[model samples]
Target: MAEKEEYVKLIGSWASPFSRRVEMALKLKGVPYDYSDEDYLVTKSPLLLQLNPIYKKVPVFVHKGKVLLESHLILEYIDQTWTRNPILPQDPYGKAMARFWAKFVDEQVTLIGFRSLVKSEEIDVAIKEAQELITYLEKEITGKMFFGGETIGFLDIVVGSMIPFCLVRGWEGMGIDMIPKEKFPELNRWIEKIKEIEIVRECIPNREKNIEHMMKIVGRIKAASKTA
Candidate 1:
């Protein structure tokens, strides 16, 4: 643990992929802070509601009384504030490309992929869509060590958070193989490479644990639908 700095705080949920991304960035940068785990259901703190009225969600960062909402936005703030190790590239084109892929993950992979998980009937089409997205990533990252190359940059963190969750849920919900070595050799290789990083390996949630949680969530949804 780094020396406790002047009261940096993160309000997030335990299993949120968004929260995990921020946490991983903080850990990687050796930022010392306090973490408050928020409940998505039942209750949300007044402070949380105030900071993020729009989303009314967790994964909010408060640094020295200034609040930041959204995981990607928070990540950019963190990198810019701390000059120690910049997460994004200095080159304009590189930065633009990074931003583009990050947006792709947020728009397509996270939103669409997660929606597909909760409704199993949509799994087949979702799997196909996700494969096409993965194919784009596989093509984009032909010879890079990280998504941003050597040093894992903004895009890496953004996209990396989704991979494990997507893998587990896609397999469990749809019984589809997304990262087969034979089909996506580059992607499979990259997945293995990213996991080798200490920050990623230590912070990423356990795949089995996530699958169990998702199963419980699915069961509840199914029960509610039957009753309705």
Candidate 2:
């Protein structure tokens, strides 16, 4: 008896780091998947709504007709299912730490960093808070070539996916350098190393175009703040 063929599909937005991380994981595992580019800012597609009625967000992973929500969860599913080019660490302790850091990146770093960029009145305080959270990452990544040690892993995918927006170009578009070379040497080095990977490079959106789109979003937020 032969095994059934699996169908994998990923619905995601071009600019979403969460979406990119899931895509990167699939690519790393060499899983073939159909991709649907969703522009939810304009309108959410019927399929997206049908698949994820609760959040209706992109980066929804569909494997053999079973739907999975949340990028981190999707990445883990892909890793466990494929069993090749492992994304998470093998050791229990290492795996736990990786999950912890990934959660930190999504919950703490991403939240404070975006607030710092858009909150003009509280920009100073927000930046300080953002930097404080980032300092923890800087220390965590010290003495390592990658978060996974020698190669990109779960934590690397989570943090690296946000590099364009949180660490480098996105901050640059807002006239700020969040990760200075002098201040964060290890992080800067890790950024360069991760960007050199073919999969990471492919997952990254075009630099100029991404910055333009982000600036437009920032403009809208600022305008809304003025009205409110």
Q: Write the per-residue lDDT of candidate 2 for residues 33-115, one digit (tens) a residue.
A: 89999977778999999999999898899888899999989988998999988989999999999999999989888877777
Residue runs of model 1 more than 4 Å from their true location after superposition: 1-5, 216-228
In terms of lDDT, which candidate is strongest?
Answer: 2
Most TM-score-accurate candidate? 2
Worst-scoring 10-residue span by lDDT in model 1? 165-174
- The TM-score of candidate 2 is 0.93
What is the C-alpha lDDT profile of model 1 across 71-122, one tens digit per residue? 8899989988887778889889988889999899888776556555656676
Clash pairs (backbone) in predicted model 1:
none
List TM-scores for all candidates, in order: 0.87, 0.93
| lDDT for 1 (candidate 1) | 30
